[model samples]
Target: MTKIIMRLQFSKTCAFSIVAFLFLFSVKAQDKPEIKIGGALRFNYNLSSWKDGQKKRGGDFGYDMFRVNAKGAYKGIQLNAEYRYYSEGFGGGMLKQGWLGYNFNERDQIQVGLTQVPFGIQQYNSHNWFFNLTYYVGLEDDHDMGIKYMHTSNRFEYQLAFFKNAEELGFGNNSEVSPNRYSYDVAGRNKEINQFNGKFVYKFGKKSASRLGVSLQYGGLYNLDTEEVGNHSAVAAHYELNKGKWNVKAQFITAAHNPENADSEDRAVVTMAAYGAPYQVAADFNMYSLGISRNIPVKLGPVSNLQFYNDFAYMEKKAAGFTDSYMNVTGVLVSAGNVYTYFDYAAGYNHSWLGGNFVDDFAKGNPNAVWEARFNINIGYYF
Candidate 1:
């Protein structure tokens, strides 16, 4: 009788094992890996008051950039990468962003590798091709080599990150800092390192149409000449509101840099570089920006939408005898099928990339510098 009962128990155990194995196999078969590839080609036309030669020649039009993007996901693991090619004068070919991430669930995830810094604003702070003044100072749309953690929900979003440094030119312990990059960084005699960032956003209004946020950043500046570490910090408060066809954005930021430099080097300004050239930026400054845009639906041939926008930003230096900088952009974006174009009229005073010499305009700016204007058109096709 005991043997009979033991046999019955053994049969039931085998059936249970088979069922569990089949269930596990089915789950594995349902999970699939996915990948997508895409890119864009862009061209630009410009007429600048500061460029007398080009202006006399009826402006210049040429290729702007070509970029490739890739993304993939398997289970909860994700990958994203982008590479861009531009004229040698504009930094040549470089990696814009690359990251590997793992999703813990629907509301949380972590990313490792080169990723965008959570700063004053996300993605962009302006509507025009030329972003706000904060971008020139590395406070907007900056990317770094780091690990970031993100959490999202219905009412709040949070991001925390620690970056070892800006993307290095090569592997191993290399000290050479190059200006061949997409984003500006400390490049001359000093390099950015050991950075920490945190950002928080609160969402409100119907369907979360509005957001208010704050961000903080602190980082070390490693001076190769002095062989000492200095520090930099920035704080920002930002708000965005979207109601029907109208949108508005506003931000205020303050930043300071204290670098340990050789005795002969200047302390009032730090050298920042990108796009194949180095420029000097003020060591201490406060910046603010406000932008507004309105979207209108249209039907003209392939045209489907148009967005008109105006963005303005200003920077005030704290150093003695230093001048301030400001930029204003008025533009319209046209969207048609897979093609988009921007028509912008930009003006700047004592600002980099607008008129005056690129290097000193953001540093001890020329108090005598007059406002300069540029009419720009950028068109791109995406796939």
Candidate 2:
């Protein structure tokens, strides 16, 4: 059912888009649409010592995904789109982002169609490929189908958005439908996701290098009626610093959800913006993260730059039964022109419900809960 729904959405809404992209190069060569073409390829070597549903250690080395980006603007109208090819599911295909924008001025703009949500710590600061726990909870690197209006000033920036599809679920890109992944899906239970989000940021320090922001989110878990049922609300605060060689970031957030109508399992349903089947975890949770990084000026062969980052993230379920989780990641990223590589070592306690081990829970009398570790490396190049 999920695949069918996504197939319908693709055929109905994006058929023309796919065709246009296939001929994008020819169109650009003949007539200048002010088009820019670029793409990226990413692959990873990952080893998971332990996680939920996994009985033993496992690892894999393979391509993660490939993406192409195109952007152009004419007058006040702008067009941006991304097409992606994944390694798994639905013949390894999907759209990552596509949007149209109208800029009223340098500081005021309106965006229509799928775009990044302006909430929490935008884009995340983790040096690792996977962001943080908030990402799994739909607070980081989350996007939606919606209309967004934004305004920016020297000291302040704000955005208002209304989204209908929560993270474009069930689109057959296995990642969005997999219950074990960090995305969300409606599971054919809800008619659509209706959400309103607002974010405000204020900068105070010189060069606006120091910044703080607050965000509010409200999502309606609509079942059948236009009068929505089920309610989810979240609030978040974040601080960031960017000066010299140091880059620091921190965030705190919490959310509560009450599915107006209970699921068959009597679980509360809340998406928050996640659009995979696994994203529907019913509980209030608090999350906080701090990441700090410093760059080292050095040239290693073609690797002309080096950056080291230490990141920590924590998530605790407000409900009584769920296990709390945390993780600390340390890595150094090397940049060689348009290519980048990350060698990361992550250690944590129950980092996530799906991504953690049960060492702490299994130890009956032992007090020191052993921490699990995963080592990974990812190399990517942009063209």
Candidate 3:
């Protein structure tokens, strides 16, 4: 009996030692440096119409897009990559984004790759869907192959970028001038642009806060003979006011120089307003609007809240002209531009998930889906 008991005790001790060794190994593994990867997928349908002679209408529905992004970080070095696939009838088939980054302390970093241009408030507010309306006239798309430097501290953040002129990539190419034979414009030939942008935000009072920002960009295009023919410049300003549940936002943007015809120039200005609290009708995400918004809560499967909004605006396009000769003949040509007035009404629903929630319902639904046949609608989703 004593011999058997001694063997049992020895086996039990060995089992405990093995289990403890595995637990410690796992803890050490968890402490090691590693890289993480994740991304999202989206699909959409869009329908849009414009007045050429009469009201022309067109629409498309398909697998709008699918995108995957991966990021790896170790110590102060970071790398990111993104790939996108779009269905038929879209501009391009495959799009890609890649970047390498380094951090200098905690408040500053430099990244080089295809990235977003840091401009208007709408450009960086990843959570706000209404920002789509504040379009800057001359800035490139959200994604461009470029290098950017970012700095952020307690109360301020700023970014600057240098980008490859997208026109050279056969992306934003101007085919009108070279319809029969291929000819490159000065801007398309050089294929480079310099951009500067910054923002200053301050928190004050008990419940109120404010922010202001400015941005500028300049680029030049050269022809085969290295002659500068097309030049472009843009500037913008943004301001925001918030107190309690009421908020106000405004922006102004101007651009000069034409991408299509190197010799031509185009310019525009935009302003917007928003008020109320989240989910509240008065606070429903609305733009350049004057109206009321209210939020109605409901118990449902996916969507838990609804917002109703109505807005009206009268807008006029600005006259175009060159900085050197604001009153030149070209400036007079700007007067021929068209002005537009719009009246808009919208109702939106927001959804919350009980468990894992990653997808944005608004972005998944058909942007042109009509609530009522009486009026047309253009909707967007954000994530």
Candidate 4:
């Protein structure tokens, strides 16, 4: 027990040292436009029915993640960065976002480096620990080593980008046949190295500010079993309404893959973002999500407001033999400045990804426990 505590402390200390150094360096820059430093500590409590058996719940406490962000503009040249320290799931505390920007004016600019892949909805609208399904699918916070040109006006925004690393995943690894965690590359397959993405968004209404967006992605997929390269494409349409205390978000996405030699369990997939099923290649699938949130006019000690939300997603494969799945999350949050707390209940039907609990439900052809419930509570303090 002592050893575990020591190790955890060591890791956090190292991460803090790096963040402190970066902040100090930024402070030295006389032209620094804005310099801010912050991170978060989170605690999670969860209930898993199958893992702990029926009607039983178990959970553990541990580190979630810490992040530091810095952004500044000196003489029209923008410098921005956001680094993270977490359980090396995707990347090992690497630069979650690091970029250098050149602005020709306010409406146009070019950003180069590891940056966001503008696809689907810009962000997600869920209180789950892992983000929405779009993230598991490589659409949410999926950043890549690439460059992009962006244009923005009062009501229109557009972006064009090329990423060489596909999903910018697979950094810490060994040689083994396993599920590809962050990248689209199939286990024991050639990696995806080249891709292009573009997005356009239009904003309307000043009071109830609404946005509609369309995105397209074209990428190359490498086959492990056949040693060949294939093509993959995806198109998405998204719409959101953010006004007053009500927020609504919705998206429709479809993808197609043409792989040389791949089976249903192995193929090029962007990410496990929201597919609760096995991976398949040479297939067509559609995924959609709708979310709504509202803020209640109530405040208490250390709790500024009360917020409630619900999000739902449905995913289906076009192939005849493929399985379909749906997931739903309904939760409430309490927000007090930089501190937030979440209480949520999530349920899945026919979910089959990542040892999901709904595998037996498909075999029995019934919702059964697949539609059972799990409760989660997360308390976080952001600095």
Candidate 5:
């Protein structure tokens, strides 16, 4: 009788073990895939001086800025954030970018929060991946808190966005005007602006790999004080050719005139005249750039690979409804190392149409050159 009871217990133990194994296998099958998280940090330094009239001035050396970016992705959702700190004397300070995105399908997605606008290529491209070229155009710090929709397919992709307008962030008084008063007040604080942006990307080549794209953007700032409005627009195009380790890219952009809106023409004239004649009226801005980058494998000391590249840029600005133009040129060089580290050197020169006097300089035929240089060390990991 004792032996019969032992056999029965052993049978029950075997059955329990089988059941547990099956349960564990099922859980493993149902478990979601792991999400990916990664980020990078960057620091830059700029030591530069200007030479004018046999004199050297405007020289300083300091930590320019630091930036951190983080990103994560799960099944159909993505989160990205960036923070920046500009050292003293820079025009900007601590800034932040955070956004949450959801992909409805493989070809469509929506993002909302504080984020950079998808208007220009340079604005969105990662710094580590940049070709390191000096583009003579002014960098735009345009950010908005809003929602954006993007769609991409085999042959075409497009984006549309709407956001809060924050023009007051750029307001200040000049010495030529009241010390405590604003030069212009076209829009009230805390008002929302309507922004519309669109892009069409087309691909060609046997495998549909090469691409050409054009984009347009329009924004309106409404004054809550007077119900008046200011407008801004931009049109741009880009083309890319990729083959093996060699790639070439070119782009052009034009911006509509943007003049300060004031309560009265006298105030407007004073502000515009002080700023410059070209700024008196709204004007269009133009920028064009060409870049070529190649990755060559070279074994040198502790570094196994290196990439050498160069980029050139030209830009022009014309007053609204005027034929006069100012031009600028920028050149850049990059040397990349094997450990995902790089050194970038850039040089730039600016020429104004206006002469010596502020107003006449803006009028026409005024040309002077201002040179600038920047050097930076970047370290990052990319996946």
Candidate 6:
């Protein structure tokens, strides 16, 4: 009887301790950080004249992608990340971007990890669904593992960054270079390393809404075959103007890459890869792009607005006898509650990703290559 009484007392003590711990934890939870999650589900429909089989079968519609976004903040610390999943024919799955950041003040912050490279226009150089030629050449919307410092205000904004290298997929220094990625990178016999970037923008007009910017980038190309380091550099100037519901964007870039490949390898072209695929691109080129977009308020059942856009880009190769490349896309974006859709009519000539033979369209494309057109529609629901 005495032993049973002692056991009951012990149980009561344990229960009291647990209740006290829970109370303390609930009080402390109010001070903890908060995280938010968001994502999107997307699908695509395409009809290309170049695809004889698809054209004969009334074109094809299939899954496009699904992505997740995460963001969190507490005090001066911030976090951002996104991951995407695609079909096997694409790059399967990859991290679009992720970064940890600290804000020193309202206008100054620093980001570390895989971050977007500040080049040409701010976020995008094109308005259509398909980006400009700069994207295919690894200039627009490029990201690398780096550290970046940014300062922003109404009058001017500037950013400086240094990337040790592109994102790695395998372990160790001798691992094979994989092409399964979202952004184009040097993958064949070379890798990009020790890259530096600087971008400055001046704001003026219409309550400081318009912007003019210049961007500079320099990097080393490490050749695995020759064990030598080559050099690459690019300079770009961009301008953006906003008037009422209309927006205009223009940019010009000159880039050159000198890769130290083995004696047997071709030096005129460098192999670039993304989306689980590899292709050759010219080593030196000059490119320019222009885009215009206008937003119109409309009421079409669940749809609330419409944005019409036209984007065009041209690439002129520096190598003698190399054919030039160009792309043009005209599209409209429809916004309806949590759903958005894009209808695009895209055409290209001697350009990769449009109907050109994936081999050398961006290197020394067929001089007689003709224009090819494709119609595409993409729909996405976001939350």
The C-alpha RMSD of each candidate to the native structure, in angstroms, is 11.8, 7.5, 21.0, 10.5, 17.1, 12.8
Candidate 5: stretches off by over 4 Å: 1-39, 45-62, 72-77, 91-93, 122-142, 166-192, 223-227, 258-260, 263-282, 301-304, 320-342, 351-366, 370-383
Q: List the residue pairs that clash in candidate 1.
A: none
Q: For residues 138-226, could you state the per-residue lDDT of candidate 1 as single tens digits?
A: 88788898778899999999999888789898544536577888887888888898799999999999989999999999998989887
Encode model 3's per-residue lDDT on 307-373: one tens digit a residue. Answer: 4433222111223221110000000000001211111222222210101111221112222333221
Off by over 4 Å in 2: 1-32, 51-59, 89-91, 167-192, 224-228, 268-282, 352-370
Model 6, position 155: C-alpha lDDT score: 96
Instruction: Kindly give the stretch of ten consecutive residues in candidate 4 with the minimal lDDT sum.
Output: 269-278
Clashing pairs in 6: none
Writing each residue's lDDT as its tens digit, candidate 6 over 50-162 gives 89999999889999999999998755456899999999899899998999777666898778778999888968898777788899988988989877889999899999988
Worst 10 residues of 5 by lDDT: 177-186
- Please give the range of 10 consecutive residues that has the lowest summed lDDT in model 3: 325-334
lDDT for position 243 in model 3: 52
Off by over 4 Å in 1: 1-31, 171-174
Expressed as tens digits, the lDDT of each residue in 252-298 for candidate 2 is 88877655544343343343222222234435777889999999988
Candidate 4 per-residue lDDT over residues 1-383, each given as its tens digit: 78569748865764575445344444333354655566677777767544664234255545665667787776445678877665655333655678877765679877767778778777553544545655544556677766778899989999998766543444644332234233223333544546789999999998528999999988766665565667777899999998998888899999786666546533423222212132333246688888888998676776788889888887666655555667788898888889888888877666443235422322222334346456778888888
Best by lDDT: 1
The RMSD (Cα, Å) of candidate 5 is 17.1
lDDT of 5 by residue, 216-331 (tens): 87775443334455566778788776677766767778866343445543212111211111233223556676666667766666555555556665545464333333322222
**TM-score against truth, every candidate:** 0.91, 0.78, 0.53, 0.76, 0.63, 0.91
lDDT of each: 0.89, 0.67, 0.38, 0.64, 0.48, 0.87
How does candidate 5 score on lDDT? 0.48
TM-score of 4: 0.76
